[model samples]
Target: MDDELHRRLRIEQARALLDNADPRQAVMLACDLLMAGVNGDAVVALAAESARTLPAYDANRRLAAVIDELGLPELDLPTAVALIAADTCERILDCSIPAEVGTHRLYVVGYEGSPLDHLLPEVTALAAHLEDDLGGRADDDLRTRLGALARTILDRLKAENPA
Candidate 1:
């Protein structure tokens, strides 16, 4: 097969490994791709995509090493937003994290000039409300709202990049 075909196969293999939560194998395959001259950006992008598949906690632990090895500051903007949104949504929906924590995560995703920048105002307002409810009395309502916002953010991201 031609070199291009070979590279594509490697890329697909790496993707499959990551999708299956096999970060170790994915990282090894990514290294091979790098040695074979695959662009570092492409490798990073592929590895970062795993955040969408892996549970948030697991993705955070696993992807950290890959990010460090690749020497990137963080995943690209869109992926970072998606990961944060997904994580916050899951925690809120399950009532696993406090309203403050979910609010903080949403705040991070709505940073100035981020892909979710348009949500900055709303997120900031929600964060303040969450802070008021930090005592846990109003947690359920806040958590539900936060979860809905997170779901909206994730849906927007998916609609934008439908692949």
Candidate 2:
């Protein structure tokens, strides 16, 4: 696909992931969008929206900082995903959220009464796919891999949800 078309697809995927309350998927989608060179504003908007929906997610803060550093109103998908991975790394090393219950807590925070609650399962499934795709990939290739994964996830989500 052309760069513009790719960016648009990334944005749409990001928005869908956010609406589905899948911050992880949204993060991946944001990475793809950034890799595609979508406007930073669009990226930031998706990050902001995800942040708004999941206030407890620290990844959102990192994404916001990246957006500011890039001097964009929002972050693109690639940048957003990178920020998320960084945040994940920090959390893993620091044990910030209490490893025993962090995943459970995140699930509760993400799906509790949210309009996108119904998508939580799909998001979890997608995250698993992303984890697999990200394994053994070089840093520079991360964005490309994420972009492809985002497209696959979006397609799967659409097929299941059909809207």
Return the top candidate by lDDT: 1
lDDT of 2 by residue, 39-157 (tens): 47646565555433554244444444444544545544443333233333334345563332222222321333343345457445444444565452323344343334334434444
Clash pairs for candidate 2: 30-77, 30-78, 31-77, 31-78, 34-77, 34-78, 43-75, 44-74, 44-75
Encode model 1's per-residue lDDT on 1-163: one tens digit a residue: 3465343343333333333224554554455556666556646554555433645445334544444554545345555445556555666668787767667766655543456778778888787776664653446677677778877877876787787
lDDT for each candidate structure: 0.57, 0.42
Q: After superposition, how far is residue 95 of candidate 1 from its true place, in Å?
A: 2.7
**lDDT (Cα, 0-100) at 95 in candidate 1:** 74
User: On a 0 to 100 scale, what is the lDDT of residue 48 in model 1?
Assistant: 51
Q: Model 2, which residues run further than 4 Å from truth?
A: 1-71, 100-163
lDDT for residue 39 in candidate 2, whole number 0-100:
46
